[model samples]
Target: MVTPAVSGGDLARVAIVGASLGGMSTASGLRGHGFDGEIVMVEAEAELPPDRPPLSKQVLTGEWPLERARQPGSATLDELGVDLRFGRRAVRLDVATRTLTLDDHETVSADAVVLATGSAARRPPIPGIDRPGVHLLRTGADAAALRAGLAATPQRVLIVGAGFIGLEVAGSARELGLPVTVVEAFATPASRVLPPAIGMALAAAAVDAGVDLRTDTSVEALLGPGVEGAAGGDGDAPVAGALLSDGTTLAADLVLVAVGAVPASGWLSDTPGIDLDDGVLADATAMAAPGVAVVGDLARWWHRGAGGFVRVEHWDNAIEMGRYVGARLMARDDAEPYTPVPWMWSNQFGAKFQLAGHVSPDDALTWIDGTPEDRAWVGVTHDGTTVKSVMGYNRNPKVMRIRMRMDGPDGLALVDLLAAESTQ
Candidate 1:
C-alpha cells in the first residue's frame, strides 16, 4: 500500500458534492473517524440518497417501496450532524482557491472537497431518444417513473444494452410477465465486465428465461407517432418501435437505454488539475487534486493490482472508495493506497452471479466446477496461470475463497488452489 503525502492544516470544513451513496458514506466515515469539523453534503436531488441496487430488482418489481432504498436517511444525517443540503447543486469547483460554487450563486470555502458527483446514464446517438416512454435508471425519480410505467404492464420492452442494469431490468420485467427483447452491439451480454464465455452463458440463461437476446445488433433510430407523422399532431405519442441497423424494426411499448454511464464532470470542466477522460482521474489514494478527492462511479483512480487507472461503477466500489477517501483525508499520516478487490453481483432470472477480482478478455478462463447450463458453476480466470478473477453463479463463498487466496503472500495459482481444494 503506497501512501501519498497529504498536507496538514486546520481542515475545518469539508464540502462533499453530490449526496449520493459515496457522499453519504464519506460523511459517515469522517464522523466515525473523529473528524469534528463541519461536514456539508450538497445534493441536487430533493430527496435523500437512496440505495440504488434494489431499484432494478425490488423497487422495479414493486416488492420494495422507494423509501426502503433511502440511504443515510434524514434521521441518520441529522444524527451525524451533517449539514445536508438537498436541492442544492454544485455548479463550479476551483481547486486552486479550494472553493465550491453552487447553482444558487453561493460559494463555500472549504479546507477540502470531495467530488462524489457520480455518473449519469449514457444514451446512444439514436434519433428520438428523448421521446416519451424512453427511460433511464439513475435517480429516484427515474426509478419511480420507470416503476409506474411498468405497473401498466406494457406488452413489449426493448432494452438497448445487455449490461447489468439491462439484465436486471429484464429479470424484473420477466417476473412482471412483460415480453422482453434485448439488443446489444457486442456478441455476448456483459462482455465489458465478465469473461466472453461467462457473458455468452448469461446470454443463454436469458434465452432460457424467455428473453429475446439479440447480439451484434444496433438500434439506429427510435420511431413514434408524433406531430411529424401522426394525424392528430400528438408529439407525445408513445414510443412505437426501434429501427435496427440491419433494416429490421422491433416493436416496443417501452425502451430502456442502458448503454453505459459517463462521469458527471461537466461542473469540473474549469477546475484545473482534474482529468476528465472517462472520469475524474484520481491518484491511487482517490485524490484528484490537492484538497480535492473524487470517488464512486465518476472516479478513475490508479489500481495497484490492475497496474493502471480503472473506473468501477458498482455499489461496493462506491461504499469502499468513499470510506477510504474519508479515512485518508482525516488520517494523521499518509494513508495507504485505495486498492479494493473489485467485486459486483447481478441477480437475473432468480440466479445470483457474483464476481470478484479483475477479469479481462485477455485472461484465460477455466471452469472449476458445475456448468453454465446448470446456472450453478464456479470459474477461475487467470492471466498466464496467475489467478486474476474468480466468478461464481449462486456460489459466492467459493469465489470469495478464491479472491482471498489471490491476496495471500504467496500468489496462488488457480490450478494449484483448485487442486488443493479438491483434496480437502
Candidate 2:
C-alpha cells in the first residue's frame, strides 16, 4: 500500500541510502534513467572506493590490491551532480514525512527514498567472539585484519560454515600454509546454493586445499581459553577456544566466521508499504513508497514470471535493478518492469564458478557439461518445462548461452541443448 504522495511538486528530492554496492548502484541508476532532480546518497562506510567480493578471494592471497577492488563510480557521481554523504549510517526512516534520520540525528528530506543498504558478514554468536584473533570479513578493514592474522606463524585456523565465504577463506588459509578446519551445519559446502551433486565438487576443492572439513557439524558453543599468556585475561567477546557438538575442543589461534549476511534494514522499521519482507518491498519499477522506489538488495518486490519478489544479493541483480530504477525515474512515463536473470561468481582453490538465472532448491537440476570427477561442469535448473537457471565451473560460454534464453519463453529447450553438449 504505497501512499500516493501527490505532494512534493516539481522539486521532488530523491534520497538513496547506502554508499556500498547498493547505494552506489541506486544513485548511478537514477542518473542513467535521466533523473535530473535533486539526488542525495547516504552511506556509512568510510571510503567511497568499492570493496568487492574479490577482496576476500584474491586480495588476501596477494593476487590483487586494495585499490583494485573499489567500485570505480565516485567520479561518476560528481559528473551526474549527485550529493553524497559518506561515512554516515542512516538510522531511521519516517515514511510519512519522507525523511530519513541518520544515526548522527541528522534528518534528510526527500520525496522518494530508496533503501539500498546492503549486507555484512555474520559472526558466530559466542563468548570472546571479538577476541583479537577472531575475525569476520565484512569490510575492507576486516579483510585487512584477517590478512595480518594469516601472516603470523600460521597456527590452527577454524572456519565456521562452508558457504561461499567460508570455503573461500579456507582456500586462502590453506594456500598460506595455515592449518585450517571447516565446520558446516550442512553435509556439503554451498548446499543451499547448488544441488548436492554440484556442491560435492566444491567440497572436494576445499578438501584438495587440505581443509579439515567436518560435515553436519555445528558449534555448540564458542569458548575462550584466554589468549596464550596474554598480558591480562579479559574474557570479553574474544574467543580462544571453541567446543564442537562432538565433544571436541579445539585450540584456535585464529577463528573466522563466514556464515552469511542479510540486508541491513534497521532504518526501515516503520517505513511500511515499501515491502519489508526480507527486504524493502517494491515492484520491478523499483517503486516502493509513493514517489520513492527501491533497487538493488533492499527492493523485495515480486515478479510475475519468477513468481515472487526476489531480493537477490548478487552482482548482476544490483546493476540490472539499478539500471531499471534509474531509467524509470527519468522517463516520467509508463515503463516496463525489470525481470533480470540473476548471476553470481565465486573464486576458490584456483577454480572459478559462475551462475546465471535463478536456481532454486525446488528446481530440478540436470548436469549438462563437464563431469563431477573432472572438477568442472555446467548445470541447468528446470521449472518443469523451462530452463530456469544455468550454473557452471569454468564454463562461461555455457553461461552466456543460458543468459540469451532468460527473457524468452522458449528457455525450456535449453535443457536439451545442455544435455547434448554434456555428452560431447
Candidate 3:
C-alpha cells in the first residue's frame, strides 16, 4: 500500500479526515507536488471550512462575510481532483486495515490518512450556562449567532475569559457601542499566552477602549432571566445576569464563554499505534502512525529545532505543518525535519500583537523597543545567552525583521541583535 508518496511506488489513494485549514493545505500540497492519487477530505461541518481567526473579528463585526473567509485555495479542491465529503464525520479508525468508518456507515480506505479534526470550544460547568443568551463562539454558525444576538442592542455584554478570543470579541462589542465587561480569573488579559508585562499592557489597552476589565474574577454561575433567586428578569427571561465568585451579579443581555478549547480527538480513542495525550502524538514530520499523518491543533509533534514537543494552534503553524507533511509523504527521500519558527498574531483592542518563536512567562524578557506603558514594543526572550523568542506589540515590522536574523550562531545574543537592528 505504500506509494512513492508514502514510501516509493505511485500512491493510489489518500484520505484526510478533517477538511480544516490543515486538511485543505495537505490536500492541495499533495496534488501540487505531483502525487496523482485519489484524495478524499471528510468534514463534519456542513459548510465548507473557513479561516477561523477571522470568526472572532471581521466575521463577527460584519466587516467580512462568511464566504469571504473561506480557507486559501479552497476553490481548487475540485480542480485538484479531490473528493470532498462535507457533513461526514469520521467515527472510527481501524489502523490494522487502514480504514476510516464515517457516521453514515460508509468506510473510506486509503494508503495514507491525515487526522486534523481540530478542536472544540470548552464549555465550563457554570450553572444555567445552557440559557439562550449564553453563547460560545467557535464555528461560522456560532459567530453568526453571536453577531445576530449583538444586533439586538444588548445593554451590556459579559465575556467569561480574557484569552485572545475573549478580548477580541470585547473589542468588537465596544466597536458596536455595547458596554463590554470582561471577567478573567487571571490577573491580566492574555496572561497565559504573553509575558506578564505584555499581558498587563494589553489589559490596560482594553480598559482604555472603555472595557470594564475585571481581572482575578470568576463567574460562579450563570443566572437565567427567569430563575427565582436570580437578579433581573423573571422565569420567562433568557439569561439575565451572571453570579460572580466575589459575591456580585453583573447584568448582561448576552454572555460569551471563551474559556478555551480542547482537541477534537475522541474518534481516535481506540485506534492502535496512535498515541493521544492532549493531541495526537506524532513525530516531527507529523507521522502519527505508519501511513498516518496528523496536523493542526490535534497534533503534538516533536519540534526538531525547539527541542521539544509542541502542539501549536495558530493558523500559520497549521498551514506550514500540513505543507511539510504533504511534501514528506510524497518525497522518496526523507524530507527535512519539521522545525518551524512559529508565528501568530492577535488583533485586540485595536492593536496588532505579533509573536515569533516561543517564549514562556518564566523566560527572561528584554524590551528591545518601546515600553509596556507605551503599548508598543519589541521584546526578546533568552535562554541564558541564546535568543529563544521574540514578540512585537504593535511592532510587526520589527518583529518580522528581527525574526529573520534569529537562526545563526552569533544570533544567540538578544541584546546585541537589538542594538545592531536599532541602528539600522
Candidate 4:
C-alpha cells in the first residue's frame, strides 16, 4: 500500500475492491448514472466471479447447475470503461496517500474508496473443525465441500446454529432425505430476529419436515474425523456425537456451523480517519470519505427507525445502496443524499419472508396477522403508534400497500386490511 501523509483531488480516481455484489453493482451503477471519471475494479478471485447465494441453496441441492450462477460478462464493465484488475488480492489500504496495495505490490490510487469487502464465515476453535465432514458456508469452496458430503445420502446430519444459514442447511438436508438435527444456543430458530411465537412456528416447520430440532444448546467440542457415528456420520467419542454444553450429546455423521458473520472491514482498520463501528461508519448520504462512499453490508450508517448505527446485510440493501452510492459519485457534487428501506428474503419451505423498514431493537411487536402458527403472518412494529416497520411472511403485497398507507394517511384508516391476509 502507498503510505503518505495526504493526497488532494477535486473529483476522484475511483477504485473498488471485491467484485462481490456491492462492488460490482457500485461500478455498474456509477457508469449508468453518468460518472465519467476513471474507474477501476480489483477482484481477488482467480476465475470469473460465480454467484454466491446459490452455492448454499440450489447449487448444493442439484436443483440448478453451477454455470447458471456465474455473474454476467465484463461487456458491461467494458461498456462502462471499467478497468478490472482481476486475480489480484487487495492486501492493505494506505489512508494517508489513499492507495491500496495488491498482493503483487502494485498500488492503485483513489481520491475516495469504498470498502465493500463482505464478511467471511466464522469457524469454531475446536480441534476437529478442520476435519472432513465438517462444513462452513460462505464461499463457493465451502458450499462445494458440503455439497459433496451431502451427495452420499447420509442418514444423519448435525447443524450448529439455527440462524439463516443453519436453517437453510437443515432444510436442504431434510430435502435430501437426511435425518437432520440442529443445535442452537438460542432458544429458537432465528431467535435474534423473530418473536418467540414466530420462531417456534419456524422450528416446527423444520420438525414437520423430519428435523430433530434441538434448541438452547451448543457444542462443547468436536471429536476426531476418524470416529464415524453408528449412523456412519462423522462421530465424537467413537460414535458421531457432539458434547453439548448442557451435559448432553447429539449424534450425526456430518456437522455444519452457521453461527453468524462479522463485518469484512478488518483491512481498513489501520486506515486513519476511517470511522469504524460494527462496520465502516457512513453518514446519512452513505459517504464515509469526501469524494468516497460506502455501501452494502459493510456500510454501517444510522438507521432512523432503529435509532442507531446498523449494517443492513441483505440483497436489497446491497443493490439499492450500491445504486445510490453510484448516483452520488456521478453527481460530482457529493451533495445529494439517498436512503432506501431495508429488505431481505429467505426461501426455505413453500414460504417466503420479507421485511420492510428497520425494526427497533426494543420496539414492541404486534401481530398484524395473528401469529406464526399460520403459515402466513405479518407484524406491525410500532414506535409510539407510528408504524416504523411492517414485516410479513407470504404477505408482501399487503406489506407494500401498508407502506404506501404509512406514507399516506390511508394506512392508519385501513388497519383492517391485515386481517384478510392473515388467514392465508
Candidate 3 global CA lDDT score: 0.83
TM-score between candidate 2 and the true structure: 0.90
Per-candidate TM equals 0.94, 0.90, 0.94, 0.87
Candidate 2, lDDT over the whole model: 0.73
lDDT of 4 by residue, 252-351 (tens): 6688888877788877776776878888887777777654577787889865444567788887677778777776665555444444556666666556
* RMSD for each of the candidates: 2.5, 3.3, 2.6, 4.7
**10 residues in a row with least lDDT, candidate 4:** 1-10
List ranges where model 4 is wrong by over 4 Å. 1-12, 72-75, 225-239, 403-424
lDDT of 4 at 25: 79
The lDDT per prediction is 0.83, 0.73, 0.83, 0.71
Check candidate 4 and list the clashing pairs: 229-240, 233-253, 234-253, 235-240
Per-residue CA lDDT of model 2 for 1-424, tens digit only, reads 2233222234367888877666677667766655678888887877674656776777777777766777747556678677888888888777767788888899999867777787666665655566677788878888788887887755689998898888888888777888999989888887777778778888887888898999998776666655333322566645666777787777777888878877777667765555577877776566777667676666687665587777788877777777676666665536666677778888888888888877766578887777767877887888667787888887877777767767664444754665666686
lDDT ranking, high to low: 1, 3, 2, 4
lDDT of 3 by residue, 249-364 (tens): 88887999999888999888867877899899877678887778888999999876777888888999889888877787787546666777788899987899888887787788
Q: In candidate 3, where is summed lDDT lowest over 10 consecutive residues?
A: 1-10
Query: For model 4, what is the error of residue 423's alpha carbon versus the real structure, in angstroms, after optimal superposition?
Result: 15
